[model samples]
Target: MAAAQDPSLFLGFDFSTQQLKVVAMDESLSVVHQSNVHFDSDLPEFRTRGGVHVHADRLTVTSPVLMWVKALDMLLDKMKEAGFDFSRVKALSGSGQQHGSVFWTRGASETLKNLQPDQSLETLLQDSFSVPASPVWMDSSSRKQCDALQEAAGGALRLAHITGSTAYERFTGNQIAKVRATRPEEFQKTERISLVSSFAASLFLGGYAAIDYSDGSGMNLLDIRSRSWSQICLEAVSPQLDLLLGDPKPSSSILGPVSSYFVQRYGFSESCRVVAFTGDNPASLAGMRLQQGDIAVSSYCLPPNSREVKAVESDTVFLWIADPRPALQGHVFCNPVSEQAFMALLCFKNGSLTRERVRDQCAGASWEPFSAALRDTPLGNGGNIGFYFDSQEITPPAVGVHLFDPQDVQVCSFSPQVEVRSLVEGQFLSRRLHAERLGYSIIPGTRVLATGGASSNNEILQVLSDVFNAPVFTLDVSNSACLGSAYRALHGLSAESGASFFDVVKNAPEPQLVAAPHPEAKEVYDQMLQRYARLEERVLQKSRP
Candidate 1:
């Protein structure tokens, strides 16, 4: 560790779906220590296959809140056993899987505030929840609730304008409405509701933590423009909803100090500040240090009541406060670091896992062969294209893998190399297509920051650069959510004293340039983009549920 004078370490926690992870960062932004507790193996008693219970219907998903509590309990013990110096940590923040929520029973707040140093958190908070299983992001069984929500808000467009999203099956508002409709007695017993992110923060703060605006945007209940709960939306969901969800705060909010339980039991400093946590995606955006504005955000300072939102006219239009109009699909969340800014997130059912699946099928189940296959294929794959969505894709709202020949005719499959190229090219094309619809463009001199499992591959990065027609840069971070939370913690330390998130993380690691767009990239892909879009429309007809 550092010499006595330099004990300014910050801590970040990521309550991901399958694991409870913590990363310690020194003042210089270097990750000093890392630890984790995987729920499946360590807590086998929960009987969670992948940290969740996928219901019989195969759409609804939930996780035991106690499993998370116990995981945190185990994680801290492991850290202590590893001789981690908690006293040196100046601040702590966290991020959790988005849209998941924990329902606290009446008076559970008191129990949280008075957590006993002598007892384990799982034991003390065992009876604290009115709902033992929290609905998670993977859940897609809220169709009825979602339909009601859309009708209640005038229409899908109005609702999307108000909440940054239209009715989504997995959003928290629909999940809450489902619980209220199905379990009236249990709803009454529930005194408060915390999104997965705030629930994690509450555990550390020893009190209920307000939902951060960034994560709150996922709920479809918060008024995105005003950054508060929308009464119209709440009235559509349930009564006393405002009380159930406490007013949201900025994501960088400093809730309070670490609880006495941590201080006494884990030797944590009493001064360790508890920063408000947010959705994992928002935290990742922060961790990515993703920058906005080439054709947008002319100034950081917006005049009071000024229009912060602009509409992008893409395949599906979403509300964003920017000057550039782009087409898109996916969610637009408030930036965790800046209230005036927003972040665009597009997800695919066929993301890393699907990519890995293709690798297994065509490349001897190894990235070595996978890269070679990708390199062996031509830039446009002889004008053939594919749409691989093993599950439902959010952007295109499609499912299953569909292939098209050079003539745009339906096909079964291609050579392994062609299959590899199809998956990679189609994926990046989808991102660029939807992002343009979201009011963003790969402007001149634009550098695409790449991360996650795929970014490590030079071949993948090269493809990414060619597809976007921009330079691709990679940040050397293991977990963006954890590191971003730690970065937020340091920001939280000085939030009230007027420190900005940029100022706090200005000295953080720089992204390394990995790939530059090929000179012939635009010529190679321009016509392909048109063909892909036409094929996407054709695939959408087949893939829609």
Candidate 2:
């Protein structure tokens, strides 16, 4: 007798800044297979350090767009090698690094729709991008564009109230303005401008994909209140902006069937559907199965929006829009799974990379040394608080490293072990400070869902737990963004049936509690956090030009 048909699978792709990761899941939401392509290590020919090319100003950062295209080709090959049955993947979605813009050349749509199965995607679409390099979220060289847009839109607060954020340099609106100002001819040749998330979806959908509402929130061009493009903000950024941005849709909307390119190259079924992709942070929120009252802190990833569609006792749907001030400090975007809900998001530029820097300096670039240092140092590092920012930070917006004594006196000296402990404490402390500003409180019953490269470190979680004074939990699966996208695919496909995303994944694995706040350390960190506030204000003033 013929073997029973294999369980249908869903695929999720996270096109992050430094890597491209894919996770496959069966109908039960259990991970079946996973793989990733590290830009620096896997595609060395791109000559990217941490997936970006940093220019002389130390502020201009861009990545080769073709690098992503080629990485996609290689990643699928890896998945095929791992015996992942592409034909079994019924639907797929993805998560991408927010605010990174991708420009398509004239006739790029024709190139995508007519891709040859016999040839590699990288080879077929080598000239598909009008702009060879894409300005990623790390670049902060758009001060001029930011100023002009803010001035045009009235001011920073006005823009923030409209777009859920001020005119951030790394945001797509400023990046687009800079391109129009600097390369007007190239802008004329550009057919479409897509965020990395939709750009990835386009690869599968066989044409340009519409931006999703949640990821669109990061563009500084979308009117968050109306969930549409702000014409004034668009005109402020560039001419004919609406033509360049085709449309924006909800994250759970199904785009179309997978492209023939996949069917020909990797044995994918033409029936495999492509769902809308969104920003990484939103994906994580969905992947973690976050309910109301839960907060997710991520490394190098942003936070969520603050709206929720509550089903009350009377069975009425309550559509709540949070006050936007908290978004000034971080970000708020629509929920990926449920169109009616939103979540709060906060990301640190000095996340894993900064810790890696400290680890290299003190512990020879190994976790063992890093863990030992945290273990040996006293709780709260004897009240020695440190703020480490290897790069410009997003929340509270400051740069530079500073150490303070228990009395809050600035100091430049500390033991390596003490330095190690200080860095870990500083990272989480800053998160707690900004999260509060965004109206997220750490109550006694609150749980911190920690995910990312650094979340596996027990010592780091200990500090995270102590600083937030909340229980820190890690998931059975680490790549929440990928899994979230996979879950989105399922949710999107079933959305018309009135099935809830939470109900769909309710039976999935539970998070394992890894760290709890030390009873004595909580009081110490509480005091240090107050001192951290004062010190950060001083640093911000010092950072001002």
Candidate 3:
């Protein structure tokens, strides 16, 4: 039996795009030992750049499914090497990069359950994958399938109303449709489809793991209002979709004990329970402990707008009725902790990367110069606004830079100071505009939780605060997803021990107040936002077919 106090530890894993990170926390929720296996640096055998194989088409992005399995094998062995005892761990859970998938062969489950204690997992399951390469979220080659599925469901608006977002090529539903159309035989041989989150969960469960409700929302298959798979969407995508995609369960549902593979191989206690893993965003939500009105503004690899929303109570177990109102452009996912609430997220393809591009061009590629530029220049750049899209953007769906002056006339030339301020102000202004359109408000007492690596920059956080006109706070810990998963492990196990999720993690270090909005800066940004709207309209008009 696991100890109740000092020795009790919970293990949480976060399998992200570039690396697989694990954190071990004690009963008090303090991190004990943390480690990671970076895919590009650690697994040189895969020969992958940034953990993915980007095709020449630039629209097709994939990763080796076996690379992830191999990563798990190495991660555990590395943990054992660090003198950590697996026996002290009471429970385990994980978070994965949302929407990526993995396919298993016919005998893969048996292979997983019946692993040899003497040998490693990679050697045992080398041939376990039926589809060697899995399409990830960066993939956008399924435009043809997205259009067809949208048409099959009546239209884009109707489809968004049903699935919580308009049909996007990156969604798993469209990717699966592309596979069925091009490679029918591979789809036939496939027995099950698992999201990246559940695939990591299955490794510990010793069989096929069911997708969790929170992660399933990204696949564009779950009925946002009903919280179940939509039959119309299933038929619209492919036949027997239900069979291929197993039933999804709540994110906190604990599966069985640790797999015999781990118990025998790594000396993991047989009593260690495996909590259902979820997507990184939902894990972050749980980690941040966001309430009904709070917003999680992440500046991670991608900028994702995560807002917690309340759902109406229903008598039926599953409501198949579609939401009659027009749906927001972002995704709606079930809250991992609270079943009664859900989260809506909007991801912008051009995030910090776009800002970094402008910084490199205008500020000599150093953040010190960029920070100085922000501090020296006045807010709104004297009514000079710019839109910088170094890559394809989601909200406006346009690329290339456009700059304007106070009189709404185009400006082709500007100094580095003007360029630097415009980039920062423009990015946040666009976010504020889209956020309000999706029902988020910047009223008094509204707290914006800023996270991710870029959040540490005071210049960036200051802009976030001034534009949103709310106090911006940053967490002490950097990896919110892993920390959240660690909390989930404890939260699931505490059910029998009588401590709720909040009861256990309430004392975990509080977020520091990093930046507060300035009334003077707020006034300038409000006027600049109006100019941004008009400039965006003129640019979109010029780009129209």
Candidate 4:
């Protein structure tokens, strides 16, 4: 494929759990058009199941290979419906939810053909005793596998040194091992193991399988420095897992053109360049235009730190803080759970949706009304309400550790209007305390840029600001992950721009609102934080071995 002229139009897909978003941009990176396609929740088979229990409140993991084809088909159909020409589309790439694994049998042309057909794809991807459905980043059934991998690789510290992460249950390495141990027949038949992002790219560009470093880093199998599969770590796990692993590629390498089959089926131009893919988190970071000293926090139910808290096996909620500087400097910390200087994050498992539910149930109540009621209530909701927001577990660590007992987790009766505020305040304190404990300065005057679904709510922003006693800025972009993915793509294209990531962020759009902390509320939150600690201890004691 020939290189396109400068300022060409690029199409980006944000492949998310609930929706597939497509954005069109010129080479200068101004968004021209964007559309989102939501999947029908009524699909019976799409419902999550573990034994007889079913989860209705969370995103159900589906096969990436299947989702990719469906998403592209949907995107193209939508584009054509909107009168957008496929031939004009120059570059095509995506950022998918990271760490999930996909495997294809080597030299199995029959299986590959079956996988591409719309009707056969779903049938082939469904879970079976042997061929299991793709384990998503949200899946946490690999604790034993994580522990076994850690031990096999010597220890957690050694594992982190090689993979830039400790063995995480949702990570590709542990998930592969789990399959190998639990479903030996399927494991024996597996061939190329790939991250969801790369897997999607592979399907689009024919059978070529190569992952970007950003996505590879999340797998708990790649050496951060070498940016390749860790042989030592791989040896620790069953060698069969290695057979499924592929080499890592940079974020910008053009893997291939759209395959002829894809072109014929989808009416996509053969000239469209398919770039290597990245994980959603790093892509979101790039989307937010985050720079040194600028922190990007995903405020959805699985706040960014879900992974970190699970990694430490900590009883309390924590954030996944990524201080890129440490990795850039080649300095590795002993504790993978600890936050590095210039970066601190706090993740709450129960995020925006909880607040939204509370808001809706308490009809006609604004976020401010909800926050005020929470403020009036004493710290820890006057020790009456204990909120445990572990809707879905984070990766790298196992999940289903008891987060709360409804009977033990009590909440003081508050006005429906203020219930949302109380929840937000509770999360604020949870995050602030954890950040402080992880050696972050957490000075009352620090500024934090909040992003994600929750960031848009003014009331939640104020509550967080008050709890942190700092300035809380709400980002304008709701899908920062998509923006970050584009940012990475743009950065890759212009190497000598001599612009730091921070500079890129500075040029981006400004936040709509900035909420300053309330001085008096700080004292109340501080007192409440202490009670939260005690409550956390009490709750965790039940699960202690």
Candidate 5:
């Protein structure tokens, strides 16, 4: 598609774990302006490590709501300082870090609507939240609630069948349940609850933004089949959640126009639409221009235009992942493209940071040496596998570093080069293993799309290709969530007109195939996966309290 008829701009924002990022694209789907706000370094007063406060319990992690608010304040000001024309932005959409919850104080909606153009968001809305710090996706302290939900729903598989996922501690429903149980006072004061995505949208919309179905599915509250809240699950957590959560909109629905605060304060056009924001994972799926079966207009799903084909093959293009443990679309999450097909997702806790730790120790904290080490080290590290996690891992719920030799005998460690290779291989191995368990596999033409800090490393991605035994592709940018949000912004305009998402984004640049699996990759990884699984099982057994 050529730049839209009017040559207007679509703005996409990503309220992520550590920062707030924005990308502006013209109708040509070309990025025209981009910027970001780093939480810890830029907003130092938050005093957050990696933008989160890890409670003494370690498993309970939260981020300051005011910090996120302030970051946005700074981000837009930076954009305005650069003389970007906000008035030309016809529509805007965004993706947020998945599952983080923001609590709105009673009457916050009215406070949002009547905001003063002169005041900063952080200043006027300082007391808008019931909880100053919101529970983030990193939290695992909601196990009690998870168990209760699963038991109440009958079992893990049943819950998974209903909600597209088993009860996960980081899920919003469990987090809300935890708050309701332990902090009844806070729960009582909360009038509206928003996921990080919708909350960010609420800031722009000047009212509560309805949670979109794509992100809503991650909460363990929305029914994957009906695309609405499960009454049983909601009642399990708290009473009358519908009033608090509002009705979730489609990922492509235009929520409303940007708030008066922006129009008067920062020169936004009154007519600029704010499309429904969604989870980062689904946004990335859209950004990657994924089609169904192979790729999807939404996460793991095909758009209505392409659904009849049953299976599709993509160009095997690339995207990036910046987070250490990115929540990737895989394994039957709700696909925003069509209700008939579900999206797939996989998340890992100890990704980039864990590898960076090993890189620091072995390769002088430099990627050049790190890449050389991976290249120099023999494949499979000579049958030496290592599991290195700085903190608790979500996948198998394991912690600490465990090393093993070819004989399955536990080892203390490896040389620097071997250690680097082990860490990279282990991460990708786990991704493939978990993906297969979800009934997805590496077909002949499987192509992985990702963008992130770690995705920049060709050596790391080579292992990803080898382990998955498929080719890996790459995009120019490192943040797929941001690009995907930008893509969704454009798609939302045609949504009411009934255009499939693929039609809107298909003309965007294609992914570059950075690496293909070596001839022996499939055979090598096949045997290695079983051993890694067994070792992981051993670690999980030991991790049990």
Candidate 6:
């Protein structure tokens, strides 16, 4: 169905983990315009020492903020070159990788005011350090802070009960605490911290500070039930509230208008409205039009939860769970995993790039040829190899550090082809067991949605399908986050009329295609999965510090 009136054009900027994607869509959700740009920025510094006793080895992690800004500039240039009129664009919203944050000093206000419409990025970059680079969500140097917070809050479960998530290395609170503990000077200098999503939105809207709940949930600071900052958590962190964080906002709230300087410089319409930003995963879920029972899965690897316990003799354990009631609309079972039913996510962080590298070095083969070779290979890769993809491990036999050796760390693999297959099968078996432990039955009939960069590869998808004994669904949208952002924007518009979130998604566009499992490969995969578990257990025991 068409919108009641002709829907205005919206430009969605997705600040993702690897790149920035910009899309222009009308009310019908048709991609009337689009542009993508790739970029990277330096990581943050973990420690600074000036005295004689100072340690020479310091940990530094890069943030994606500068990359985002540069990409946005490039996208605008491309849009202008394409001859898309800036005046027709009516709204602006963004989707960014969740949890990562940008710390903006009060000094940013002055630089933001002086920004000319035609100012070059070089000029901006020269002053870009005015605010420290955004702390990316993937940085894991905050373990000390995470442990401290858990101790301060009483326990891990208590902290998780306060925040929706347990203490993670990537969560914003731990990152902020790390800054405070390591570099008190910089922490004092920081004026306000905003998640990447909100920070990008603030830039377009001139300058503002407000976070969306979906992104806030990833911070481990927001009280999910209250949809606001948790006093208990704040007291535990002892953060200078005014400078360290911003007021939280709903996902759809209009933060402000695009600055006149940006309008004149980027040639964007003055009528553009800046909406709140959300995490990429949450955006993808919204974009897929996921319903009450619809599951949203990602192929990206996740860190394993060390706190997970196997079910015991007691059928019902009365644990004080974090009441997700504030965020819940209706009665629904919510867990550490995705809230959607039967969410079978299988992530391989080092999956695609590693596979490409392997093919390049060993076989001197292209992606298509290598994938075709994989097809010829039998289930469980003919029992000739066991490939372990170390993207993210979430359940039993969790292995975070990369381990490619059983004996010497420097020993080289004798067979490159066998090594490659081992990595792939490792990820497949890990996902299967993870889902099963979560109370999901891993059978031939289970349907799984495969997304992320790895999802685009038919070989990877097929291998996953065979290994898991389930049908793998691939989405048409190359960037699920951007599409999800658009879905959220449409929902925001529809929400003005007080429409249900499900109703809005139901009226949205349908997915591109659905890939089913291969029946012949199921039994072989089941046997191989058991072998993978044993290998993983032995490997982890040897690798521990």
In order, candidate lDDTs are 0.82, 0.82, 0.79, 0.57, 0.81, 0.59
lDDT score at residue 112, model 1, on the 0-100 scale: 93
| Candidate 5 accuracy as lDDT | 0.81
Clashes of 2: 7
Pitting candidate 3 against candidate 5, the one with the higher lDDT is: 5
Residue-wise lDDT of candidate 6 within 15-96, one digit each (tens)? 8765678777777678787787655322122221110011123233445355566667777777888987777677777887
Q: Residue 350: error of model 1 in Å?
A: 2.7
Q: For candidate 1, what's the RMSD? A: 7.8
1-545: candidate 2 lDDT, tens digit per residue: 99899999999999998899999999998898989999999999999877888777777789899899999999999888888789998999999998899999999999999999998889998999889999998788999999998899888878877887778899999999999888889888999999999999999999999999989988889887688899999998877799999879988898999998899889999989999999987787788887655666655333211112221110001111234353566666666666665666665667776788899999999999999999898878888988887667666577888888888899987889999999988877887777666556555467877766767799988888888787888775478889999999988888878888887888888888999988887789888888888899999898888
Give the range of the ten consecutive residues with the poorest summed lDDT in model 4.
Answer: 328-337
lDDT of 1 by residue, 246-287 (tens): 999999888989899999999999989999999987887777
Clashing pairs in 2: 303-345, 303-346, 304-343, 304-344, 304-345, 305-333, 305-343
- Stretches > 4 Å off in candidate 1: 1-6, 293-328, 352-384, 389-392, 399-422, 523-527, 542-545
* TM-score, per-candidate, Cα-based: 0.86, 0.81, 0.87, 0.70, 0.79, 0.68
Which segments of candidate 6 are over 4 A away from where they belong? 1-7, 17-19, 40-58, 64-74, 107-130, 240-244, 256-271, 288-347, 350-426, 436-446, 452-470, 500-502, 505-509, 512-514, 517-545
Model 1, backbone clash pairs (residues 3+ apart or across chains), number: 12
Candidate 6 lDDT score relative to the true structure: 0.59
**lDDT score, residue 63, model 6?**
52
Question: Where does model 5 exceed 4 Å of error?
Answer: 1-6, 40-49, 54-60, 116-119, 293-332, 336-340, 349-392, 398-427, 450-460, 519-545
